[model samples]
Target: MALCEARLEEKARFLCRGRNPSDATDLLQDTYERAFRAFHTYDRNAPPLPWLASILTRRFLDMCRQDKRHPQQQLTESLDVPSEEAGPAEVWAGYTLEDVWRAVDLLPEEFRDVVRLKDMEGLAYAEISQRLGIPAMTVGTRLFRARKKLKELLLKKAETGGAS
Candidate 1:
């Protein structure tokens, strides 16, 4: 439990990256509670992080489906915010991890998943391929494309004063 608690915030923040922070917090708490209840069933011999991640991914998907039923509950505001009095570096520093995630969300679903798993979640290409059920080579390809796309988008946004 102590170990799980220590990593809970990071796991939740990753799962909720593109979503509202409040909702992300709620989802994280719910995931923790669910993990607690199911702790006994967890295989001690198995790697816990991947197991926890599988659960988190499922829960996030469930929440996404539920959110679809209530469109009004979704955040419609543009995630990109202009830099105020702050300089570019300051504004960049002010950008939340969530903001970076919002940029990630702008990616196509396949690309987004690969980037999240590889870069954010720190999963190896083979692990990501297995988890996402894609070929390892495909994982590399997708990750390359995703990075390129994200770079383009971020650069464009920065130029337009839309991203810090």
Candidate 2:
């Protein structure tokens, strides 16, 4: 319990990286409560962090669904943005990591999960599959598509003179 409490903030931040801080806090608390209640069921030999992460991820997804924050809305908004015609220099001028993360947040849930697992979390493909409960091949496909979409988005930003 003390160990879980110590890691609460880190887990919350991981679960809510692109979300409102308040939402993150709520989810984190819920995750801890859930984890504590189910701690007895957890296999002692298995990796606790990943198990906790998986639980939190599912909880977060449920929250999103309950809140009715449709991924389709984000997808529509992203698709509406016109691509930029500028070169790489103009495209990367104001490209802070936060901006990149915001772009990642705009991705559809499936693609966004892959990007977060692979890029932000630095998990291997196999690990990502286990965490996401998807096949390894699906992880690869989602990652490829997510990268392509992010590239397109950044290019659009550059072309629209909004890169900076």
- Residue lDDT tens for model 1, 33-80: 788999999999987777777777778889877765543224222122
For model 1, where is the 10-residue window of minimal lDDT? Answer: 73-82
Tens-digit lDDT track of model 2 for 90-113: 345457666777888889999999
Clashing residue pairs found in predicted model 1: none
TM-score of 2: 0.46
List candidate 1 segments past 4 Å from native. 1-96
- Top-lDDT structure, candidate number: 2
* lDDT of candidates 1 onward, in order: 0.69, 0.71
RMSD over all Cα atoms, model 1: 10.6
Error of 1 at 143 (Å): 0.5
TM-score of each: 0.42, 0.46
